[model samples]
Target: MFLLSFPSLIPLLRAGLDLDCAESWIEEKGRPLRDFLSEYSKAAVEQGKLRESDIDNALRNQYMTLMRLGYFDNIPRYASLNETDICTDEHRSLAHDGARQGIVLLKNDGNLLPLDPEKILAVAVHGPHARAPEKVMDGDYTGPPCRYVTPRQGISKHVKISHRANTTIYLGGINLHIEREGNDREDLLLPKNQTEEILHFAKASQNPIILVILSGGGIDVSFAHKHPKIGAILWAGYPGGEGGNAIADVIFGRYNPGGRLPLTWFKNKYIQQIPMTSMEFRPVPEKGYPGRTYKFYDGPEVLYPFGYGLSYTKFHYETSTDGTSVTLPATGGHCKGLSYKPSVATTPSCQAVDVAGHACTETVSFNISVINGGGRGGAHVVLVYTAPPPEVAQAPIKQVAAFRRVFVPATSTATVPFTLNVCKAFGIVERTAYTVVPSGVSKVLVENGDSSSSVSFPVKIDFSV
Candidate 1:
């Protein structure tokens, strides 16, 4: 991961050094946040709240505070910090930087994105949740203060002008912090008022209205169900201080805004509707279960599903060799007994190799090509999966093995071979059979969505040999 920090470094140095992208890459990738931090840092020095040497010291303190927030559990990159108190600049930057990456672009039919601000006439922003939380609203913001740019504030940078003017940008979604019960929202839908706001703007806007939602979870946009006039819908999430600005940049073609949801944004569903606790659990519908995610949920549904996002540009993918052979890596023996590396065993041709003892070869390789088939540049990820044999006493249906991301320039193509071995393929089955079966061929496939069309290859296994 650290190696990703200095992306400009030579490939060989990274390969030899086994270097990872430094955590600072978060700072590097987030230019707006960094600039905010730099300016805020300077402000602190002038205010006598801190000194030149205090920058690092303050970061350490904020790191600790972040860790204790429990938000770090979901976000591990922030775990490395040891500081407890933080400077306002650093704290605000951290929030903005983290939220920026979490933004997801749900759909962009034919790449109708990266809107041109100069061309746009108006933008209308609304949402019960658009403004800061009530706590933030009522509290005394004594520190450097919680500076934030709302979707409305952010969008203003690119567009000409309009609050009640010509064009419009609708910004609002579910208020997560607002409590309906002792527990927060279990149902992922736009709050009642927020949904109205979306529809209200859709009707009110004279020019093409851009819909943007600042939410922590997914919401039902079915109201916009095939609505013709509404131009774009952006799942901005809880983007922090610079969120408004970053979103504005993305809207008006300043940034490509290549982001996808990390979680499922259901049209109408909740966690209980899905099976997480019991594999043996049967599907129940009358209990308001509409199936969960791309796994069991049938098609033509979902406002947006996981891995769903769009870019200003479009992308296409191609594959070369459909066959594969796997090779095992050197790993501690104890881990081997716990988890199996299927990359070393499963091949496109349905072959399985044993990954138990020493490093072995059952190398499976797939040549994948990506093309920027649209107007601009975009990134694509090749997700590889292993299917279980036709009959398994108790086995997962499929397991993700290998994934690769590539940036394709407009009207250009790039091809890279993805290799997967044993370890990458399977998870540990505690107190279960550890033996390898050699007779049947294992199915390997490459796809995007869980059910997205993919090319598959078969392999031959030789466990006894």
Candidate 2:
């Protein structure tokens, strides 16, 4: 039998009873509101007081509001509304797109990544969540689909994987909701025996093991070093539906992983002195904190640095200019001397350099080149700047004046030209009793990534003032 079926009852309960108590009573009194709306809507329609479409809209709005308030799971209702098609193409696309976007490039020393699937033998896939499905959209705990792709399944498409096999590839990690929501992880270890399993495989296996972490954030895997046999590790976060396929593609050298880390992975939780625990915002001044990331951080070297990613190839960087001194052709446009020993571009004039002279009136060109010696194609970053000693500018340990990314093929090289502007160059911050001013220096530098670490070359220009 229908009871007090009133739309306004929700507001009355909200105002009078605690949310928790109200939810319990509402669940116990469910049919009342539904019955009232159905009957009232029918009467209104019959009397022409309200249109049928209006009633439908009101009901849809009420349902959605309840869904948002954690009062219901409306998936079944939505599923039926869209033409009884149990499975939609959008669900499949979401899975694929999610997986592809979650691939993270952590490290690539000696270009050991994008595994050669053809040469692979037996692979070992181990991890609690490796085959587990993510939590349902409504936060229900559902086991993995029977037809799921674990690391073994995904990689097997390209190469043979083993339970007692040759190479071992471990894919496992905690899900995102664990650390982000359901009360942040108490420890930084890879969840659910994943760390122990990886270590066990690395020790027992004779062939190289690839450890892939399927997570949304970093985890402390100090044990990683103990498993030197684990040749490579890739952080493949909770990739959407296509994640399994993408993981396989990367392993088989089908896709070159070019993604860089958006966060630093520490050795463990203890090492992450300032963990992101508090959701509240705290304002820190610019230049307020130093050595936070790879550069200025006073802590131990991280497992991986931010902006760190690997390719299947290697690049050798050489600059024609020095930190204390830099050179560019007087004519301006592109500089010629900015180059590498063995580069991708043939014509020196294809690139440019710039130089400045006294009274801050100079312009010139700079050229840079790079060579790929690895067996695969990848990209290289060329950074240029005019820098002083760290004590001199109190500037960023290294100031990047200009930069470029040059793509190179295996066993090939390329050259790029950059022009330097005088007004941009000869400015120095002179500190008086209180303020800093733009003064002149006798020299400027053009170098690679770090100014202090790179060799210095003289740029011919007059800066005496």
Candidate 3:
């Protein structure tokens, strides 16, 4: 069958007649896949599996798909294709803006960040990734970036401008192959040598320690979390070409970080408890499945929670709501929380129903006012979360329903309004059915950096299946 399907192997069939084949078949070249497919189509037609007209139709469809995708004469032709012209000043500015905005300030104890570049005599930058450029790319999928900026380069440039220094110290080397298609890390902690290097620097230097971490996934930085000397932490996820400059800008107060964490950063101890193979979205108490994500995770307090990020400056939030009740569509089933037990797996439960068989809903419209209290102008992301009442079933502890990024000038306020449909916000899914069971009051929280305001509204879930 292989010889018949692969035209290049037809010669092998003739060679097989000799029966004493000793050399490897790796040297054999295969015919073009298109030519092989054409021959295969002819054979299939003779065997009655496909009609002659079917082959023509398939080829025509493929040609049409290619044409639609601009693979033929429709290709674009620009006037200039020079690399420098392609990457314009506007493009560089946008890249810089992206890098600055995406920088998440994980920790800044005692307001140690937004470092005054002029205050220090000398600054020491050391990490396996601080000077390494290879850390930016993921395997062969991405070519070497046009411009590379290591964290060290970024920090040094700004430091040179601010402070004149004769000697700079670089310490410790921690290298690991963490990015690959099928490979996974054995653990989440930093390499032992890396930790030792940090400790060595901490003990030797009298100056403030600013730690910059580069990683695609979360790392357990419990040691740094407790360390008194380490004042700041910047989680710069593989910043692209302008990463170094962006890091420098944020450090020197050129940019204010508004990026929030997309996932939870677990501590070292929690790493072993939550196995990577566990896929349950809800907590499994019996087998010790802690569950995944901030939505269902009922484990130990994480190092950094989802949507948690620090900024150099602080902001305050004021929230007000417009409505009290909403109405929802009904499903024809019992309204209850869905549970997945190994022995007794069943469909999701249903909510209470009205005489008209429509679920009761409430629309909560919020007017959130965010004021940047600090001196620096920066952007703030307003996050809105909804918590279901106790009687409600199959709901997360709290879920983010709405979010917005607003830029508020120093001492100025930005009012961002959002309308949420309570019925849709609190809906849960069973095997194949979706139901909303809001029995009591639900809390709505509007949160900004360091501050949050919440309001409670009574819920009436009345629907008929």
Candidate 4:
């Protein structure tokens, strides 16, 4: 999991950070890395900063992990990693499946997707990403893929999307040039030229055009969402090697896009008002600061909210709440006058609790039924969010307490059973330690696709302890 990107220790390593692994520096730096590490470690140990045992443990852990990965074997895994071993049929299939799961159908007004080949004859493809997999198909770390399927190549085979007249597919997103390891995006809007180009094409065109954004982060695509000509939109993220094939499959109805957006798509002005370096999570209206994430941000309406996605088929969600409230246990010395006589927390003031303890077993359960009304069978993600009482300052507007994915057959229903531990699910944090505060007005919201259901319930914690 760890890749040594740097040969020098000065930048990354500080006093307490022990380097368990380092790249070969002799070839570039004219000295072995161990020489510098030995001197530094000796000084650290003598200064009572680091213990010899700590150094041994760190190296031991690193070696154990490497050994488990077959690093010390006579025939290590990489030794046999030939071209044939790298991108096999299985690997390609996995890459395709991953891309299918990640590609989000952002908008599908008037059911404008699932292009039927029999209905359509030809199409227009624009933007640089449509032709090749130069940047959008790859991210931070990558190797030459066995094959690359551009959007043009993928969509070219099955051209028909809808009966709603002439179609144009615009692929304009961004690459690593926008955001990466050391880089921060200056804005969320697609470049002015790209927006102008989309608008220009849209103006001359008819009713239904498709726009596909292929970036890792959120982009402000309010124009296309509201534009009458733009009928459908997709966020293909940095779809990997098999990206084109997956996209074509989704468009042609060979595969249904069941993936949901992992982030909120804020407007261009949101990033302009908020600094890139801002780390505040909660919103403070008095200071004119909107929050961040689905949990906290109170900024202007996001172009697309978190967990937003449109499916080719409609899904119905029905929740059967087990109980409105769950009772926590009192245990240890902390249990004094709590409801159950035992404590949910192992420490004073209920900072943390033992989940396996007697008090934490009982949870608020919800049985969610996902019924696929459409003829097509596809995957659906069930997101459960819990909102603490407004009185709790640190508590988010809503938090994703739990979630599950279920594949309901066509015209069938699948029940997703989700539970939340009374103590942990409702806790609020202030700096280092968390404080448990149960609210009678707490609400749990269960959402799937475009439909959402909610139930108001209270989590009873033995806070008296």
Candidate 5:
């Protein structure tokens, strides 16, 4: 029953023979085996366990598999593949594009962003990440990049080209630490010295100040968030090889930012209340669990919401639904109430069939029109969220079902259409079965940047199984 060598045993298994044999046995029994296998296959077909053509088909497939493996081994040499040249113009341009899209404008008060290069008399770049190309290039994979552009270098190049400022200052902060496996920071606050250094530069600068943050994750920035002197704040998250050029592009109005926050930027104090390991989706006051994620957390500890981001150009959203409701057959068992628990021994099933024995499905579709209200052109990411009916069992406050990124010209509009399965979004998990009792109303919200519009439709669970 044991397979000492897989390849040697494959033929025996395919021929429907189960036996344990040694390598020496194979030498004695397998060499002149064409006549033996042919007779054995003929016997197997008469016994009805296998078709007469099965043996030939299996042997042909096995031969083809071996040939494919041999062919794949020479592909690298045949194609002349080489390591990526991170320093090439093409690579750097791609890096610039990536950095531009990754940069998020968290706070831009008084229309201070997209700095006018002509009006500025002086510029100051102050941060640990200002000139550290090595730190910025240390990405998650492939170690450090071969070449990189520092924030200082990027700013200098653009400033020189525009002749925008008479002077520039570099006020350094804490050096960035490359995060490796099993090494995570204890807190989200900037180093004490770094904070002090930033404050010192902000107070000493005579002209408008720009604070550019460079790190991989969110940090507490309540002070900078409210600071009046800090004209602009850009979150340049570990810009790779061409980060410097991309930062300069955004600073000098060459590129309008369209990136949104991928994670919530929580205040430092909230970390104490919500441990990273908490798995509860809803807050448990009795157990002191604050819950997790943007779907359930209701506290004011968040500095920025999940989808919050800023842009140089403004956008407006006009959303409308088809005003139609769908009814799907209700199958599977339902919990009596929120506190009801099903027995562990019970087998759960989710087959949707009506009394007439017909499978049922429902689809929901909507449209969102995004208008570039600002004079500048930029890309907008339209987010669509669905709020389940209040009567739905154990539903999140809202869930993002669909999103689309679109480029709209200055003073132009782009219409985006989305089709989604309503059952997938609104279904409730009871025991192990995912079921939908489509009753009451569900709300759909279309959002982009700070604008949002919503529509609601009622669902009827008329058919039962």
Candidate 6:
């Protein structure tokens, strides 16, 4: 972090950057953190950049931080950390779990998954990215792993590293180049038409296709999602070292997928009008800036909405609500710890509720039951999305208020409880002051994999009248 203290890197550091974007991408042998700190001082003095006292202060703070982190302590926690501490069962399990749960089941058309090993016989896997996870990338910031689980280790020699389950399993995705940091990506789709390549194979093979995607962000998969030949699709993301095992477990029905997409996979045409440079948070219809995220973005319906995913087994939800609507009285005197700048408008008004203060207490709550509709007993995630107050000009179309995951048996129900604060959940940001949870009706929609149910919530402010 000594590099962060450099006057030249101040702008970048302020933008939440680390040493990665700093001028020193590498330090050939003798140049360690302290050496770099000294070098920065020399440059500052010679170039008349930073004052001597300022340089000294920065150096002092960095050194103090290192010391506090135990650099000079009698017993540093990392003093003897060796290779043995690297890949333990705990570490491997964490990696495996992350990859497993992060794997989003993008599509499982016609109930083509939870592959019936007894009937399907074998999975004919073939894809550009069907090899071991380490081969794609291992320890992106560090060295190689102690070991990695591969298809050869998991399956037999004949059942090689290829994608196309259901007899045809096609695995394809991106690498460290998710248009990541330093360099940028020009195209939304992969370097090659990996979809076309899969389609070609799908036509040649007799069986249906199962496409596994590995990438940091979503690309245009409208073709595959709608294709009659491609029956199942899974997005593994950058699953890490234990990714192979996780993929296998999902494919073979050993593990049930309850993971959801981390982002809204908008189609490629989205950028045609919506420039990447557009940083405007809200949509301006007069200006034609479409806005962004599942929160805003009006037209050009996304290929998959944020938090969209499927489970091996289907689910239906039933909610326990307080009838049609319930009114909440906002009469709690002066909301204890709340503070905000008064609205610049002459007629300024706001609900005196601090986000932190309300976050600690439950203002409203409801219960939801998740029932597994499919024959297979598996886990399901019940997503609760709340429609924001339409009165607010710059409000989201909908916001994910709460979510709960439950392991329900086949054809059985599991009740999931959700709590939310009306002021925090349905409130709108009008300028810098008033956080108006405008008194009116806001809708709360709960969804399982297949269907959704809505709950009406009408809030009334006791003090407003």
How many clashes in each structure? 49, 39, 15, 6, 0, 12
Number of the candidate with higher lDDT, 1 or 3: 3
Q: Please, what are the lDDT tens digits per residue for candidate 5 over residues 274-342? A: 676776667766767666667767677588777777888888877665456765655453322221224
lDDT for model 3, on a 0 to 1 scale?
A: 0.64
Residue-level lDDT of model 1, residues 274-373, one tens digit each, is 5444442223445544444443453345666666666666665567666544333333432222233344553333233333543544566668676676
- The window of 10 residues in a row where model 5 has the poorest summed lDDT is 335-344
How high is the CA lDDT of each candidate model?
0.55, 0.52, 0.64, 0.71, 0.63, 0.66
Selected candidate, larger TM-score, 1 vs 6: 6
Per-residue lDDT of candidate 6, residues 94-154 (tens digit): 8777777877898887778767666666667677787645646342354565567753344
TM-score of each: 0.62, 0.53, 0.75, 0.80, 0.72, 0.80
If the candidates were sorted by their TM-score against the true structure, best first, what order would they fall in? 6, 4, 3, 5, 1, 2
- Model 4: lDDT to the true structure: 0.71
Worst 10 residues of 4 by lDDT: 334-343
Best by lDDT: 4
Per-residue lDDT over 103-127 for candidate 3, one digit per residue giving the tens place of the 0 to 100 score: 7888788887786777754565666
Error of 3 at 362 (Å): 8.0
State in Å the error of residue 319, model 4.
1.9
- Looking at model 4, residue 116 earns an lDDT score of 76
Q: What lDDT score is found at residue 241 in candidate 3?
A: 75
Per-residue lDDT value at 414 in model 2: 83
Candidates 2 and 4, the one with greater TM-score: 4
